[model samples]
Target: MNEFLLIFRRDFTTAADQPSAESLQQHYRAWKEWFENLAAQDRLVGPTKRWDGAGKVVRNAKDVTDGPYADIKESIGGMLIIKANDYDEAAEVAKDCPIFAFGGNVEIRKALS
Candidate 1:
């Protein structure tokens, strides 16, 4: 089996663009169920983690800045690794990701050994 990285990117930029608290709660539940399903299928690998809104950027070993990013409207919500037979299989698995429900996207990349 090969490993794949799934990066969840979503837009929660401004207050006006953010989802309601109740809607967020529902989305959280969906994520929980999705993880559980992957676990049950023996596909999950390593650790799963969600990122905070805060961030820092380092440049040329000198300059540093705080940011989620001003250039990009969407933020990286979280990421996790999973096992799959190939890119095709990984793509199939990613199709079930709940991020789609919230107008987000899942980027699937193969882990090189």
Candidate 2:
């Protein structure tokens, strides 16, 4: 089995506007359930949701302090590191991504060993 890094990218502002607090709680619950199922099946390496304010891109040796970059239209929301049999299996795992409900995108990349 090969392990792939599932990078979840979404328009932060768009997803933020789609759900109320209660709806968001439902989504969180669903997200947790999905992760738990994956864990039970031994398919997840780990899942991670990053803080939006932690982005930093350094160019050359100079520390350019622009910002954390969450203001961008296509900021990376979070990621899942999953162990799967193949890319097809990985795609199936990503099918339940919460961002998809908001028309967001998920990118799956094969990790270099």
Among all candidates shown, the one with the greatest lDDT? 1
Error of 2 at 76 (Å): 1.6
Clashing residue pairs, backbone N/CA/C < 3 A, model 1: none
- TM-score computed on alpha carbons, candidate 1: 0.91
Backbone clashes for every candidate come to 0, 0
For model 1, residues 1-113, the per-residue Cα lDDT tens digits are 99999988988877777788999899899999999999999999976788897797777998788866657888888898999999999999999999998889989999998
Candidate 2 local accuracy as lDDT?
A: 0.76
Best by TM-score: 1
Question: Local distance difference test, per candidate?
Answer: 0.88, 0.76
TM-scores, all models, native as reference? 0.91, 0.80
**Model 1: CA > 4 A from native:** none
Residue-wise C-alpha lDDT for candidate 2, range 45-85, written one tens digit per residue:
75556546356766687866555563477667678888888
